[model samples]
Target: MVGEELVGLTPEMIEASQAGMKAIGAAIAVGSTGLASAAAEMAIGSAAVGATAENKDVFGLVLLLTVIPETIVIFGLVVALLLIF
Candidate 1:
């Protein structure tokens, strides 16, 4: 995008530029949330694993807790899709 002209641009070119910005926004949305989810899961999942190892009966609860972080990624994907289309 270096050396790109800003002046004397046609309507179609301007529209295309806006569309590209939207795509970048969508990518940021999904990527940031995905990273957040990963970080949350890193701590929660490790703890869950240890908890489950200590008591077999706690496996179900830990499993549920481990999976809850993933919901943020789903929401991010939805937002990204909405931005793109």
Candidate 2:
């Protein structure tokens, strides 16, 4: 018994640690994208409002541009899904 390794991880400990890491990874994936999407929306939304006020004709195009940032969140969701399952 004296020669036994004093410090080492058991199989269960390794599995638990891996699971926790995966959860953290998934959270980070979703959280960072959500923040990016919000930041992009803030800039685009302000510009779109200003353009609409100056000239009504560009409202439709501006609206489309504002929504483009949302796609970034979807990509993050896909990454989270891949990580989880």
Candidate 3:
């Protein structure tokens, strides 16, 4: 009886596994993109600081460039929501 129970795959168990997988995928999507965005921002921020130091007039352009990496995180959040829902 124990062997039979262990051998059979139940519908609830299948559903639980599917839910776990979906959660994992969502976490990965959000985490990876967040990390990428952080790295991009770090690189761009340093470059922007240097550029701003060299020319005060280019501050606006540098600020725009520095903010661009934030979109990656926003896209990541969208992907994670899609996976969850």
The top-ranked prediction according to TM-score is 1
TM-score of each: 0.85, 0.78, 0.76
- Report the C-alpha lDDT of model 2 over 1-85, residue by residue, as the tens digit: 5336524768798788898898899899999999999999999999999999999999989999999999999998999999889
Question: What's the lDDT for residue 39 in model 2?
Answer: 100
Q: In terms of TM-score, which candidate is stronger, 1 or 2?
A: 1
Q: Cα deviation in Å at residue 45, candidate 1?
A: 0.2
lDDT per residue as tens, model 3, 9-62: 788997888899989988988899899988999999999999999999999998
What shift in Å separates residue 14 of candidate 2 from its native position after superposition?
Answer: 1.6
Candidate 1 lands at a TM-score of 0.85
- For 1-85, candidate 1 gives per-residue lDDT tens digits of 5437656788899899999998998999899999999999999999999998889999999989998989999999999999898
Between prediction 2 and prediction 3, the one with superior lDDT is: 2
Q: Backbone clashes in each candidate structure, one number apiece? A: 0, 0, 0
Model 3 alpha-carbon miss at residue 10, Å: 2.3
